[model samples]
Target: MHIETQLAQHRVTGLRAQADAHRLSTEAKPPVELRTRVGWTLVELGLRLASAPGPAPAVA
Candidate 1:
């Protein structure tokens, strides 16, 4: 019984490690600075769109 319990605990620990590995693999995304810079620049440019364009989209 003790050995079975230990095996079960080991299996649970191994599963948790596997889950952590997968979570990190999926969630360790690259920084958004590069994308944000272009978006921010566009937003800055669009701020004066009323006088610059025929029809400009709303910016977030």
Candidate 2:
């Protein structure tokens, strides 16, 4: 193949890949509000676990 034809094919392939990536990203992501709420819930759970008392020491 000619160099110019090869370059054009490469450009087309790159553009198609970029379009696919953009479509997947937009379609697969959860809504921002839901994501934020879930993130905060996880943070709260982590904080609670961290602050909770440890188990009592085992007797010999």
TM-score of each: 0.46, 0.50
> How close to the true structure is residue 44 of candidate 2, measured as C-alpha lDDT?
100
Clashes of 2: 0
TM-score of 2: 0.50
Give per-candidate clash totals: 0, 0
lDDT of 1 by residue, 3-43 (tens): 99999999999999999999998889876788898999898
Per-residue lDDT for 1-60 in model 2, tens only? 999999999999999999999999999997779888999999999999999999999999
Score each candidate by Cα lDDT. 0.88, 0.97
Q: What TM-score, to 2 decimals, does candidate 1 have?
A: 0.46
* Candidate 1: regions farther than 4 A off: 30-60
Candidate number with greatest TM-score: 2
